[model samples]
Target: MPLVNRDQKHYPGLAQTTNYNLSSFKAAEIITRDVVVIGGGSAGTYSAIAIKDKGKSVVFVEIKNRLRSRTETYKDPKSGRGIDIGVIVWYVTPRVGSEPNTTGAVFDLKTGRGLNAPPPNQTAIGIAFQIYTQQLLKYPELDAGMFLPDPAPDDLVMPFGQFASKYGIEAALPTMYSFGAGVGDILATPTVEVMRAWGLSLISSLQGGFLTTARHNNSELYGKAQTELLAAKSLLLRSRVVYTERSTSGVRLVVKTPTGNKLIKAKRLLITIPPKVEILKRFNLTTQETSVFKKFLNTGYYTSVVKNTGLPDTLSVTNFSPDSPYGIPKMPAVYTIGSSVYTPGLKLAFYGAPLTNVTSSLPAKTVKDAIIASIKRQQTANPANPTSFNQTTPTFAEYHSHAPFWLQAKAVDIKAGFYKKLYALQGIRSTFWTGGAWRAQDSSDIWRFTAEQVLPKVLKGL
Candidate 1:
C-alpha cells in the first residue's frame, strides 16, 4: 500500500514565466497542484471542489464536454424520461419516516431495507445519498438546484408487482425489463447483489409525485459546479486524459482535446471512470496489476432511460410489454415512464439494467426499439400475464420513439478484493479514484461521503 502525499502533486502556479527552454527533449508541462482529480461527474467534480475549498490546488479532467448529459436532467430525444431508471434518489432522516428509521444511516427497519440501499440494504449507496444531501445542505450554493425533503423516502420496499396493489401506488416506469435484460441472470446471481439492484429499481420504478426544484432544471447543479471549477481553472470539460505516467520527475498526464494534447504534470491522479479492465490495461501498473484491473472492468454495464407522458394527477400508471404466446421475449412499441406526469411535457426517464448476454452488445436505437416492443406486448397482454399474452391482443399505447440508455449497467463483481485494490491505488501513483463504481451508487451520496472521507485524506496527504 503506497501512499501519495497530499502535497505530492502541487508546484506553485508559475508566477515567473521563462521563455522556451526546449533542448531536443520536452520538459513535462508540469504545473504543481496539490491534487489531480479525474472525471467530472458528480463524484470527481465534487471531490475536486472539496479539495480546493481546503486551500489545496486541484485539476479535474473529463472526456465529456459537459459535466452532465441532458438525460441526467431533462428527457432527451434519444432517451425519453417517463421513468427515472437512473438511480432514483431518496433522502432519509428520522423525520421523513416514522419512529424506528435510522437518522444518520439510511436503513429503514419498517421496509426491511436501508433508504435506497442496494440489495439487502447494502450501506454504500444509501450512505452516499445521505452524505451528498449533507454536503448540499452545508454548501448552500450546491443545494440551490436539488430537491430536498421530497427526495428522501420513508419506507424502502422491494420491487414486486405489489406496487399496483399496495398503497394503490400508480406510477409508470421504463421497461428496462426489456425482454429480460439481465433480469433473470441478475436475479439468478448471488442473493445480496440482486437485492441491491432490485432495491434501487423498486424505489425508482414509480411515476412522478416526488419533489422537484422550483426554478432551474435538475442538472443546474452540474452547471453550478462548472462555474465554480472554471473560475479556478481546475475543471477541464471536454478534455480526455489519454495517457498518464509516473515518471521519476513527476506524474505526467496527457490530456487530449480537439485542438491537441496538453501535458499536465502533477504529483497525484484520481480516476473516476467505471473500472473498465481493458481501459486499465493502458495504465503503467506492470502487466500483472494492469491485468487485474482489466478483469474488474470486464464486469460491464447497460444503459437505458424511459419516456414520460404527463398523466393527470392521482392517475397511477404502470407499463407492460407484449410478447408472443409461445413465450418469446417481447417488447412494446413505446413504454410508459414515471407516475403519470402531473405537469405537461413527456417524462421519459426511468429504470435501467445491466447487459445480460454476458457478450450481447446492441446499438442504442436497436435496444430502444426492442425495449419499446417488449413494453407494447406487455401492455396488450392479459392483466395477469404480459409476456405470455396472445399476440393478437392490442396495446394500450402506440408510439415508436427513441429512448436513452435508461438501464446503463455497470457490472461489478464486488468480488471482494476489488475495492481493496482501488483504495491501495490512492497514493501509489499519486492519484485518487471516485465514482459510483468505487464505493457508491448515486450522485448525491457519493459526493457527500467521498468529500468527507476522501478529500480530507487527500488534503492531509498533501
Candidate 2:
C-alpha cells in the first residue's frame, strides 16, 4: 500500500497518516519520492504504474481531479444512455487466416465491440504507406516503435500535402483526414507527424484492431488507470505544479492542491502534459529547452455535444472552401455524429480548424458558437441542393477543449534535429517527458510505448 501525506481524500488500501503533521519539515508540506509524474493522462498514469511495478515510489500529480484528461462520460436523462465525450475509438486492422486484412475497423477497448471501417482508398493508402516505409528504411529514427520513438527522430520532415502529391495519393486526402479534430489540419501537417498519428501501419494491427469506450463511455480507460495507480504513495488530485526547479541531484516542485501547497522532492520527473510555452515557463527550463519548445505549433481542437442544431439529422458538417487544394470534394469535417451521443436530440461535434483560423485562447463557449455557425452555413452552402432556411440556433449541451493538441514544428525545425535535442533533455536536471507530442495519439500506443521504452529510461534515473 502507498502512503499518502494528507487525509483530504481516501483510497481503498492506502494508509493516510495525516493525523501527524510534520511542522518541522517546512512552511509547506514536503513529501519525498523516487519519481514524480506530472499529468494524469494515459502516458503519465501508465508510467506511474510501470515505474511502481519496477519497485520505485512515485508521486502522481494532476491539475484535474481525475486520471483521464480527455475521456469523459455524458449521461442523458431522456434515454438514460451514457455516451463517450472524448477519447472514443482505437483504429485497428483485423487478420484473415495468417495474413493481415487490408480493411480496418474500430474496436471499443472497454466493450470489445468492433465496427467495420468504411472501404478506404487502398490504392491511395498503399502509396502513402509505401512512401513512408521507404522513408523509415532510409531513416530508422522515424520508425514508430510501438507508438512513438523512444527518443524522437530528428531531421525527418516534410509536409503531408507534399508527401501525398509526391506519391499521387493526393486524391486520398479526404480519407486520410477523416480522423476529425484529433488530428488538426491534415494537409499542412508534417508528413512524419501524420504517419505516426494515424499511419496505416501504426493502426493496422497493433492489437488486432481498434478499441473504444464501453457503455460507461470513454471514462473507462481513466477509471481503470486510477484504480491501478491508487497504490502510488502520493496521488495529488486537483493539483497544479506552480513552480519547479531541478539540479544535478534531484528535482523540486511546488504544487498547489485542493488541500494546500505541497513541496515535492523526487530524484526524477516525468512530464506528460503538452509543453506549452506558458506552462513550461513555470518549470525553469534552460534557454535551449525554451527555444526548442517555443518552436512547437499548437492546434485548436474542440469537442462538444450540442442540442437543437437546426440542420437536418441527415447532414453532417465539414469545413472547406473553394480554394481547398487538389480538388478534393467537400465533405463532413466534424467526423462522426451519433444521434445517441447522450440522447436522440444531442449530437457530438469534433471541431478542428487551424489555430490561425480559430485561436487557442478562445473560450469554450466562443468556439462552440463558431462551430454552430459553421454548421448552419454548411447546411445551406451545398451547391447541389442549396437552400436558405433559418433553423433554431443550436446551443451547446457540453463542451471540451482538446486544443493545443498535435504540437509540431516547421520543416526547418525538423531538419535542425529539434526532436533529437528535445529527447536529449531526458535525465537532464532529473526531468523526462512524454505525451501526444512525444508520440502517437492513441491511448493503447501511448501505454505500450510507456511500458516498453519510457519506463526503462525512467527506471535508470531512479
Candidate 3:
C-alpha cells in the first residue's frame, strides 16, 4: 500500500484536514493492510473474511464489542436456554447451509384462533406470488444490487399497494405484510423497495426453505467469525474511526480504541455502515456523496424478549386489523408477540414504526410500554375465552434496536436514478460501500453482494 505524503494529491478539497500530523505517528502506532472494513456487521465481517481468503491482509473495525447485529441470542438465567430475539430465521443459502424444518402456530389476535388462509385466498395468493415473481424476473439486475436501468420503470417506482392492485395481486398483501413486519408501512413503500425487502429468498423461506443454527443460536456464526479474525490478529472491536484521509492512491484512518489510537493505512476502504448524512459527514464526504446520502431515510424496527407474559407457550400472536386493507396493521405498531421454540417461558415481540424525523428518538422504554399495551388490548378484544388471556405484567428481558433500518430514498428519487448515482460512488477516493442500503436488507443477500459485486471492485488494484 502507498502511504500518503504532503506532495501527493488527495480527493479535491479533502487533504490533510485532520490535526494529527501524518508523519508524527511512530511505526508501532501505524498498522497497514490491503483493505480496511468498517462496521462489523454481516457485510463487513464477510468482506474481511473473503479478502483474507484471497491471501490479502485486512483490518476489521467495529464500534460494538462484537460482530453481527442481527443475530443476537439471549440466554435465560434459570434454564440456560438461548432465546433469539433478533433474526430468528435465515434464508437457506448455499454458503450458510440449512437446518431441519420447524413449524409454529400463528393466531389472529382479534379472533384468538388459528390464522389460516382460506382455500380461495390461498389460491389467489399462489397466483399472485407467481405473477409477482414473473414481474421481478424482468429486473434481474435488482437480484444482486441496485443496478437499475437509467430511467427506472414506473411500475417499480410506484407505491407497492398500487403495484399490487394494478397486477391484481391484492390478495397477497396480507401475507407480504406479515412477512415484511420490520419494513414499516409496506403498502406505502415503493414497489422496488418492497421487493428488495421481501424478495425471492424470503419468498422461498416462506415455503419451508429457511434455517436456524443447530442449537437455534444464530449468533454462533458470528462467534466463529470473531474467532477466525482474532486468530489472524486482524480485528479491532470497540473501535471507531475518528478521522479519515482518502485519495486516489490509498486511504488512511485514525481509529480510537480502548487502549489508544491506532493509525491504519490501507489500499482501500469498505464501509458497510448505514450511509446516513450524520454518519457520513465524519468521513469528509465529497459534495456529491453528501447530496446522494442526505436523501436516504430509514424505518425504526425493534425486537425484545419479554417474560411473565400471559400468552400461551404454544401460540404465536400476530396483529391483524379486521377493517384495514388486506388486514394490515397500522404503523408504529407491534407486529407480533409470540413464543419461540427455543425459549419456552419467554415471548418475543417485534415492533416497527414508519419513517419519521423522530423515528430514532423513540425511547426503548416507550417501545416496551407500547408492546405491552398492545398485548393487553389484544387480550381484552378476544372474547373466545377471557380466561385464556392472563393479565400479568410483562417484563422485558432483552431488547435490541434495529433502527435506521430498511434504508431507502423517496420513490421520486429512485425513479430519477438515485441508485445509479449511489452506485457510481463506489471506488471514489478508494472507498467502496456495501450494506442493506446498497442491496437487499438480508444477511444472505448482503453477503452475496459483497462477495460478487463490491469485493471484486475493492480488490481490483490491491
lDDT of each: 0.42, 0.63, 0.80
**Candidate scoring better on TM-score of 1 and 3:** 3
Off by over 4 Å in 1: 1-31, 69-71, 75-186, 192-216, 247-250, 297-336, 339-361, 378-418
In terms of TM-score, the best-performing candidate is 3
Residue lDDT tens for model 2, 1-462? 112344443321122223322233374478789999998987887788777878898889987878888776777767777767777665454422121122232322122223333455777676755555555565444444322343334423566777777766665576567653556667767767677665444535433655553464667767777876765445888887765678878887766678776788899899898876656655777777777787777676677888886544433333333345742322223443334422556767766646332225457667666667655654444324443223567787788877667677666766666677777766778888888777777676677666766777877845
TM-score of 2: 0.78
Candidate 1, residue 133: the lDDT equals 34
lDDT of 2: 0.63
- lDDT string, candidate 3, 249-350, tens digits: 999887777767788999999999888766664477888998998888888888988888776665677777666777787688778887765566688889
TM-score (all chains, Cα) for each model: 0.57, 0.78, 0.90
Candidate 2 stretches greater than 4 Å from native? 1-28, 91-140, 145-156, 180-182, 200-208, 231-233, 312-323, 327-338, 355-360, 378-390
lDDT of 1 by residue, 1-462 (tens): 111122221211211121222222234443457677776766786777777888888888776787753225434344343233333343342122111211222211112121332222334434433332343243232121111122222111222233222333212112223322333322223322222333332333322233433331446667788889889878777776544576433466655555544567666676766554433423445443554454442122233433332222222223332222211122322222333233333323222333332222345555455544543433343334422323332222322211211122222423333334445555555555666544434455566557755666566656
RMSD of each: 13.9, 8.9, 4.9
